[model samples]
Target: MMMFRPIFASLFGATLFVATVLPAIAQETLPSWSDGAAKTRILDFVKATTTEGGEGFVAPQDRIAVFDNDGTLWPEQPYYVQLGFILDRVKTLAPQHPEWKTKEPFKSILAGDLKGIARGGEKGIVDLVMSTHAGMTSDQFAKIVTDWFATAKHPKTGKPFDEMGYLPMRELLDYLRDNGFKTYIVSGGGVEFMRPITEKAYGIPPEQVVGSTILTEYAIVGDVPVLRRLPKIDFVDDGPGKPSGINKFIGRKPIFVAGNSDGDAEMLRWVTAAKGPGFAMIVHHTDAEREYAYDRESAFGKLDRALNEAERRNWLVVDMKADWKTIYASEH
Candidate 1:
């Protein structure tokens, strides 16, 4: 019976090893991802690009990464967060713009009639955006957005819009940054609108964000200089416009690009077309239980052409349901 003592001690040590050592071994950069092809491909790409003297080694200065904001980073369904802000702004400033009370798009927005707003299509949506996003000084616009996010919540999730960012993507961003890649947000959403929230949400600073913008003019108000957002369309950073925005803003073709829809197709095309090793990935929203999942025929973040193109080009297609173990950054 005394001979059994050492064996029992060995069994206790093995249990301790299983509890502690196995977990540490499993610790990975993307904790929200299930260890599978999607995660493996991403990690492999990062490793290849980052390894010193490796065939795919990208110089630190040239390690540019561009990401889409709306559906790519956070949730975009049920209208974009920016559009939500505009609808709320229509309500906030309706008392001031009394004519907007009965205005076509503005009236629809104010009444919380999204179906009505959708019927107006591109022209009506543009009208709503211009009215709400323009007229204020750039500083004032920032302040308005900053304040709106304080109280706004996603109608479906009931979580703050800022907290809706995906854990896997956030990990991807940090992981890339850690590997010396400079990340930038290139979205169809308004640049001014995203700059205020991105740093806190994605660790991307305001200067690195590029998006649609209305022209601004220098003015003096009460002896203080200000840049007032004019009521003119400067650029629309969507569809084909994404690549143009990338060239005009980042000035270098990105080595890495991640987007979720057809809107990002051109950007991915341009980035991958560059004459060297590059990676283009699309985040396919597939989790309806954790987040809204719409693609192909969806009005926003339509994934049809992009999905086919990604498959043809052999780009990474991250199926959110299968690839990710957790969706939100706050989730374990």
Candidate 2:
């Protein structure tokens, strides 16, 4: 009986030991991020939130993190994927319309004159989207996106559109999840377009994504109720609209937010303004050889205002040329 008592106590002790150490071991085995101040701050923030007795400790459910998609999660040049989708749509639909052959933006797109298409500016891009994406049911639009992402390839890299995502950002997303953060993507791109592919690319489910949306309505298509996507813009999740969308959709201020341009300034401001600990990071594209580099003068993802604000606020500005060990995962 005495020997049996000792054996039971040892087994109980071993069980306790495993219970205490298993989680730590699991955390330690997470992918190693680069050794830099940005990585250090990220790890420290996670530890503070997840570890008991830490001042920044937040319950797992409240550990919300938001990211901007285009230039943040993935590459946005030679152009945004949504733009490519629209261009393809223009090409496909041009035969039906015929007038597009003479239309300014559509004409440039059809002629493979990207510079001319961009010359139409943001308004040009918006016109292209409205022309191609509007007048379709939401289900029909979703099918278009699903089909395009399946076959679309980057012009320069010749990789699937899905493969153009930044490798380091993907690792950051996983790291946050490992630490119990629920990540959301808030982007200026069309919500429907992003929702179709984000889950596969970012590990963020569709429900957690926020972006520009068009008005939708319920309709009965042949006795089956269906939600139809309308072209009337409901919201544009860019700049200040990013913060507005976050509040409307998430209902809670994020503890972590990351973006890459002036379009993200308001979102970072909103997140950093939270009562307690928070992190705001900006991904600065500076590696021209590995990836395109543009900031103040670039037509998209311009960083001037946000860059200054980040510097003034001591927020992390990820130098693509310096901080990242690798750019796109495919490059590695």
Candidate 3:
């Protein structure tokens, strides 16, 4: 009991609560979610999986759910939150590295040239991340990221970066945990970067997060042992890498997975293709009034291929405009 107890997000949690709990609790499960097929499907999946004797019933230990962070949990419009961090970090460290004044991506970043940065593609973004995110001890890097979140405000929302997580999704995390599901974040963003704010912003702890990571090694400094952050990337938990990372780090095949962009296509595919009952959903960006809406052609959070694949795979395509009652945490 000691070993399995901790893995369960909510012991005595799952379908029983939904069946026996008050109407208010049921309504509160996903308060920000509008009444629609999307909502119905999610609730139904939980019910089925938690109903013991039912064909869809899954054991408590098998109830694993994974989510993509940026676009799914919060807005990744204009630019990714991590990319925003990278840009700001470059500027912050620019005074220390005077050579960055004339560097390609660094120079473009300092000039506020999003177009130039885009021109460099994924390679350029990776380079920028390595430059800004590495060289310090792991603990030092985490502290820097935590400090950045404390003061960094979104250009569009004017809210702190930590304040932008989707309230509906936050509710969903609680709902799943209430239903005995172990929730984990498998995002493309840096693991260390996401770990700082995840537990407070969302309910997930640092141990449950799996994401892209740079290399790190143990070293003694000033009579203290520490894991030093290295510039070389160790793994990228996105696109095709998502499934591989999950297999490598998480071990268990998740029964539920949610994502927002093409970067999440393979993850959705991987989860839904499994032998048992699996549920996959894509948070489609469709509300221009409350949030930015673009797919297929958008540079950031493009949802083209996965959007197309949803129908064939029986995946839930959540229409943000029509399905969500509110967009941000403050909206509710």
Please count the clashing residue pairs in each candidate, in the order shown: 0, 1, 1
Best by TM-score: 1
Segments of candidate 2 deviating more than 4 angstroms: 1-32, 119-123
Query: Ranking under lDDT, best-scoring first?
Result: 3, 1, 2
Error of 2 at 237 (Å): 0.4
Residues 101-184, candidate 2, lDDT per residue (tens digit)?
888888998899989986888788778778877777878888989999999998778888678778888888998898889999
Residue pairs in steric clash, candidate 3?
A: 14-179
Candidate-wise lDDT, in order: 0.90, 0.86, 0.90
TM-score for each of the candidates: 0.92, 0.89, 0.91
Residue-level lDDT of model 1, residues 9-34, one tens digit each, is 99999999989988886665788889
Give RMSD (Å) of candidate 1 vs. truth: 3.7
C-alpha displacement of 6 in model 3, angstroms?
A: 51
Better of 1 and 3 by TM-score: 1
What is the alpha-carbon lDDT of model 1 when measured against the actual structure? 0.90
Expressed as tens digits, the lDDT of each residue in 1-332 for candidate 3 is 77887557465575556567866665665888998899999999999999999999999999999999989998898788888888888988899989988877888989988888877777887788888888999889989999999999888989997689988898899999999999999999999999999998898999999999989999999999999999898998889999998998899999999999999999999899899999999999988878898999998888899999998888999998888898777764
What lDDT score is found at residue 252 in candidate 2? 92
